[model samples]
Target: MFTGLIETIGTIENYDDSKDGVVITITDCSPILEDVHLGDSISTNGVCLTVIEFDEQRTKFKVGVAPETLRKTNLGNLTTTSNVNLERAVTSDVRLGGHVVQGHVDTIATIVDKKPDGEAISYTFELRDKEFINYIVHKGFIAIDGTSLTITSVDDSKAQFSIMLISYSQSKVILAQKKIGDTVNIEVDLTGKLIEKQIESNLRQQMNNEESQLNKLISSIVERKVKELMK
Candidate 1:
């Protein structure tokens, strides 16, 4: 689990393909040798990756990306110098900033438009594949490329949102590197997913209860008719 608070803008230093998977090296602006170790989970571009090795002193870290993760995230397209949002897994005592992020990519959304809205920047991204859009809700929270943002508007296949880029968000994350046509990974809020599940579960329970009641009523009527016929 993660807090969605980006620690720094990490750049891809190197990537090598091997038979099993790809080994990735990343460099970031965070404090040197900040105690990150092997097996630590890092949120890279809204996707979770495990650290296979680290050279914190040299400001370098490495992760082994499985092919399955590559298929679900934009990490596969990474090359040397690709900047990404970086965040480590939260500790027990850290403040719960942002929202709960599983670092799981739901689907890919394309940026159709970007413009300024008041003091913030409004981005319009088209939601392709109805299955992905079904999870989107207006004013709800979403994490795109590991940066948590709120939805401002919604259409059949498009979503619009204005995000205020405070100084911290601008400096700590990779917003400086964002371009119009670039594709980023997306992760929906865990709260929204759970609420969706609850709704479905409640509806199924109600239907089952109604069916049981209907069956009992029919049995009662049958017994009453049998008594009347015997009389």
Candidate 2:
């Protein structure tokens, strides 16, 4: 698991695609690669990739991207010289500066707009799949390109949400350098999705005995959860 905190930005040195799968070599990551191992997992652009090979100097590392990951994330769009957000798995002793992130990409979103907001910059992203908008809430946590950020607002009409990056964060992560039409991998709050799944399962089990009561119960639970998140 990860805390969704980006440690550094690593440039894609090489992107080799073959009939077997995709292997990417990332350079300029000597800091985090110091204690790395062969099987260690690194959060690359918010998608967990296992370290398959590394050089003795530790300046660069290689990881293989699965087909499923390529289909679900923006990693497939990356090429040589692309910069990606990088974070190592959190240790038990470290403080979780960001929310829990599984390094699992839920979906990819496009940067629809970006504008200056005081010393900070605000970005608005439109989800490629509208169905996932249900997981997005105002003030809720969302990890974009492995950087944890709070949702400033949500627009159901456009299937979009906004986030603000302080000046300090802008210098630290790769998201600030992206263009308006560029796509970024997104991972929503895990807690919210878990809660929704549990409630949904419970409602489904009670559907046979009391359909009307189950519907009311599900509605009440959803409404209460929404209120709690908004607060």
Candidate 3:
């Protein structure tokens, strides 16, 4: 699991899409790659990717993106020079600076609006998969492009949500550099999803139990009516 706090911004050195598959090489990651190993997981643009290879200098690393992951995230939109938010998996000793981020992007969202809010900047994104909007809420936590942020407002009708980034965050993550039409990987709050699932399961079980009890009552009534008719 991750905390969604970006450690550094890594630049895409190479984006190779060969017949074998897509392999991305990210450079300028020395800040987070100091203790990197072959199997270490990195949150790149809000997607958990394993380190397939790394340079001896610890400045660059490569990861292979699966086909399904490409479809579900905005990673496919990255080019040779794209910048991505980078974060290492959290350890037990580290504080939970941000909410728990699994680096499992549910879908992609398009930047619909951008405006200056004093020293901060506000961005509004329209979700591509509108169904996921149910998971977003006002003042809820969200991970956009691997950077944890709080939702300032939500518009269900437009399938959009807004977030404000302070000047400090603007310099740390790639979101501030993106254009209005650019897309970013989105991971809604995990706790909300879990709660919704649990509620649905409980309601379903309750309905089943009620149906069984009703069936037993009907059977009992039929038996009593048949006995009276025979008498």
Q: Model 3, poorest ten-residue lDDT window?
A: 206-215
Q: Which stretches of candidate 3 lie over 4 Å from their true place?
A: 211-231
lDDT for each candidate structure: 0.75, 0.93, 0.93
Say which prediction, candidate 1 or candidate 3, comes out ahead on lDDT. Answer: 3
Candidate 1 clashing pairs, residues 3+ apart or interchain: none
Off by over 4 Å in 1: 29-33, 56-58, 157-168, 208-231
Q: TM-score of model 1 relative to the true fold?
A: 0.82
The deviation in Å at residue 94 for candidate 3 is 1.1
How would you encode candidate 3's per-residue C-alpha lDDT over 74-180 as one tens digit per residue?
Answer: 88889988899999999889899999999999999999999999999999999999999999999999999999999999999999999999999999999989889
lDDT, model 1: 0.75
In order of listing, the candidates' clash counts read 0, 0, 0
- Candidate 3 deviates by what RMSD? 5.2
RMSD of each: 5.5, 7.2, 5.2
Per-residue accuracy of model 2 over 60-177 as CA lDDT, tens digit each: 9999998888989999899899999999998889789899999999999999999999999999999998988899999999999999999999999899999999999999999889
